[model samples]
Target chain A: MTELVKVKNLHKSFGTLDVLKGINLTVEAGETVVLLGSSGSGKSTLLRCINFMETPTEGRVYLNGEAVGDDVNGKMRYKEADLCKLRSRIGMVFQHFNLFPHMSVLQNVMEGQITVLGRRQEEAKDKSMAQLQRVGLAEKASEYPSRLSGGQKQRVAIARALAMDPEVMLFDEVTSALDPELVGEVLKTMRQLAEEGMTMICVTHELGFAYHVANRVLFLNQGEIHEEGQPQALLKTPKTQRMREFLDGHALFKLPE
Target chain B: MEWNFAPVLGSMDILLLGLLNTLKVTGLALLFGVPLGLGLALSRLSQMRILSMVAAFIIEFFRTTPPLVQLFWFFFAFPILFGVNMTPFTTAIVTFSIQSSAFFAEIFRSGIQSIDKGQWEGSKAIGMTRNQTLRRVILPQAVKRMIPAFMERSIELLKTTTLVSTIAYTDLMYQANDIAQRTFRPLEVYTVIAVIYFLLIFVFSQLSIVVERRLAKSGEGTVH
Candidate 1:
């Protein structure tokens, strides 16, 4: 299987403080990689760097064998227009549902397609409706985002991303801001996408979802991959003391005997 | 001396004509200023060093000086400097548009800046270019917030037009002053002019509040 995303020697820093320090990783096509880490472990930063949302201080990121933020005449850069095109193919869902509050749910889904992909209005509408239906929000299309529940809004955000038919989707602690009761609906939508073979890199603390959905789980600590393996094995027997201690803090995960 | 109200009543037509000029000047200035203010505000926030500095300098210069002084300068000095003579009406319009645009630009900047940064990031994440993001996402929200401020500036612009009388422009104040000098009834002439200005401005202020309420009811201002 071809690697869908490749990160080589990725390092990100804000001023004097380092966020992602010389990290290297890859995601094969159709793979679901769950990134688990304590706060400040740079999981979000790593995800952001992949899209060049926060430009990596040093490193190269490749998506589908095409280099992103490439060096142009000794300067690391991607042209503004080119960067926008690259970003569209890699869908990102934030922890907070960043749906355009001024627009109705259907419009939010339709906007990127119409503006970026240059789809005809009718075609964009038809596709947006289909994606909204997939997320079970077709009825809420006419309503603005402020009117939706947190779970419903996040689902809409996912549908908005899905309408782009992105090659890969990145989830940044998408359920962290939701109440416990509201978390399941969002996870269910994500699970359906993973099942249908959408390549995904999720930064999440939802250990249960990570255990069930992820093909590989990389446990991050202090800007490095401290431990990684198949979820069943790693969660069952953590290889490092830090991983064990981190897993121990969340005693909620029941071991499957 | 028996107080006579006949002169004030007789010259009511001139004052009414002057009122029309005031309304005309205010309307024209708003038509010109609002869009120019938006452009100026955007330039002030632009990434280009020279453009932002130029915009900042112009905005600061206009905002700090009194409109009366600016009007006098434009009416008296500008023709001398540029070697092009303009009618007093055109001069008044030019002066007010420049002066009020600074106020409007500052208002626009505050309204635009008040929008949450997350809105900008979200639009960018969805693959919108900066201009597209601004046109589609930011301005729609900012424009709603700017209406009341725009109306407030319009009221100020209306009042400022009275200063044009200093340059012999035949606005309501000029007409009133002319009548007072002829009739020597300064108190009565000034009082009538003040009452008329109050009524006109009061109507606009009420209109502004109504529009603001409707916007609130339509759920435009509430951020998600």
Candidate 2:
């Protein structure tokens, strides 16, 4: 497998507090990698830095071997316009699907294509309808985002990103904001996308979904990788004490410990 | 006293001419005010510190001062200050536009700010430029929220066209004043003028309600 993304010594800080410290990672093309960490472990921050949503203070992130964060005077900086283009190449999906409220589902999806990519309306509308149908929401294309269910909104958001035809898709705790029942539908959509060989980096606490979908799981602890292995090896077998403790802690997520 | 409705009927031809003049002023004001108001709203919401601050000062000044005073200054005082010869009707339209824009700008800004932050973030993520996002995504939503307020202002502007008579412009109020002066029927003439104004404003308000319902039903479109 060829490397689709590469990061080296990634570090980011807000004021004096270090959020991401020395994170190094590489993902092969068409690979699905799940980042497993408790909240505030810098998993989401790492994803943001990948897309230049949160600029890394010191490090280099490469998309298709092109460095996104520039190395200058021992600090990495990104120009805003460059970041916009880089972000287009890297689509970041949010926990709460950020669909435009003032637009129809069709317009919301088509807007980027027409306005950014400068496609003609007919061409963009055709592609947008195709994507909406792919996500099982073609009938709802003329419907507003306010009327969609959380799952449907998320699917629309997913379709909106897909319309950009980005090289890498980032999911930041996508199901964390969904209802317990609704989570499965969105997960199913992601699972289908994964089956269709879309390169994805997902930061999620859903180990079951990760086990079912991710090609590999990267376990992070204290803002560093504690363990990394295949899903079967990571989930079903004995490994590091850190991994054991992490999985055992899932019992607290249960009613009876 | 018995009602003398015959005079009003006899003078309907003059009233129609005044009505036509009212439509012209109203049309010109809306055409000028909405776009000018949009620009003001954008500048006021601008990231630039000094420009937005100055815009805030202007909005506050116009909002606090009477539009009639502003019109007076534009007609009488500003000519000496600027040393330019502008027409009375032109001056009336310009002054009314400037006065109406402050309120319109504030309304637009509120409407824009009312939209979800998600729409903005979503727009950016989709690779749209800042200008494209504002034009396509932001303004459409803002304009929708602004329609009712826009209609209310249109009616206000419809009434404020009367102020044009002060500048010696040939609008509805000017015709009414002229007719009242010549006919020596202040009570009858002014009463007829009031009813004409009422009819225009009433028809306009009803039309606005219909547009509002259509927009609300269609889910999202242009401002009513």
Candidate 3:
């Protein structure tokens, strides 16, 4: 399998607080990597850095073997235009749906396609509709986000991101803000995407999703990867004490075999 | 002192002309100010330190100083300082345009800043350039929320345009002053002009209320 994303010595700092410390990772095409960590473990930051939403304080990110930013005198220098182009190829869904409130669902999905990709309006609308249909939100295309349920809004957000036809999708706790029952639909959509061979990196506390859908699971703790392996092994037999304790904290980690 | 609106009514043509001039200045100032305010707001919000500082400085300078002083400076002092002829009409337009723009800029900045940070992240994630994101995503939402504040500022601008009267511009107030002197009926003339101002401003307030209701009904301006 060809590597689609690579993170080498990735370090991120907010002022004096270091969030991500010397991390390296690689995801192959069609691979689904689930990131598991507690709050403040830098899971969201790591996902953000992958798309340059949060620039890494140190190190580099590569997509398809191409560096996201140019190296200048041992430091990464990014032009806005270049970063924008790179970001367009990496879809990200936020914890809060973040659908444009001013626009209807279809418009939200079509905005980036028409504006960023410069697709014709008619073409963008058709593509956006298809993405909405894939997420099972095609019927609600004409409705505003404020009128939709949390799950429906999230699905529209996912459609908005997917309308770009990105190479890899980054999900930053996409279901974290949903109602208990609403999370299932969103997870189902994500599972369908994974089944269809879309490369995905998800930061989630939902162990059930990680166990069932993920090809690999990485346990992150305090800015470092504490443990990582195939989901069946790592979720069941954590190598480190911290990973074991972390798993112990999550009661939902166990599922019927 | 007996009440006699005869003199005030006699100068109706001149007062109407003055009212028209008042609207002209207010409308022109709004035309120039809204776009200028948007520019200043964008500049102030820009990441470039110097540009934002410069924009901030301009906005503060115009907002802090009195509009009357600004009008006086533009009308009396500008011609001498800049070696250019200044007319009362042009002075009214220029002074209020930049002055109201300072206030409008703040309204615009607050409106734009009030949008959720997630909107910016979402737009960025989709690969939109900053300008594209702002024009497509941010401004469309911000403009709606700003309508009420914008209407308030516009009404303020209309009242502030009356300051042009001190410089001998024939606005509603100036014409009232002229009619009061000629007719020797200060009470009647001033009261008539006050009523006209009240009617004009009241109409605008009602219009703003209607627009706000429409926006609310349409499920907008509630994104926060």
Candidate RMSDs in order? 2.0, 3.8, 1.5
Assign candidate 3 its CAPRI class.
high
Worst 10 residues of 2 chain A by lDDT: A248-257
Regions of candidate 2 where Cα sits further than 4 Å from its true position? A11-18, A69-77, A101-108, A120-148, A219-257, B1-12, B213-224
DockQ of each: 0.72, 0.46, 0.90
**TM-score computed on alpha carbons, candidate 3:** 0.98
Candidate 1 deviant stretches above 4 angstroms: B1-3, B218-224
Score chain B of each candidate by TM-score: 0.94, 0.90, 0.96
Cα error of candidate 1 at position B16, Å: 1.4
Q: How do the residues B71-105 of candidate 2 rate in per-residue lDDT, one tens digit apiece?
A: 88998888899998768877887887888888888
lDDT of 3 by residue, B4-117 (tens): 988889899999999999999999999999999999999999999999999999999999999999999998899999999989999999999999899989998998988999
CAPRI class assigned to model 1? medium
Rank ordering of all candidates by DockQ, starting from the highest? 3, 1, 2
Task: Give the whole-model CA lDDT for all candidates, comma-separated.
Answer: 0.90, 0.83, 0.93
Q: Name the lDDT of candidate 3.
A: 0.93
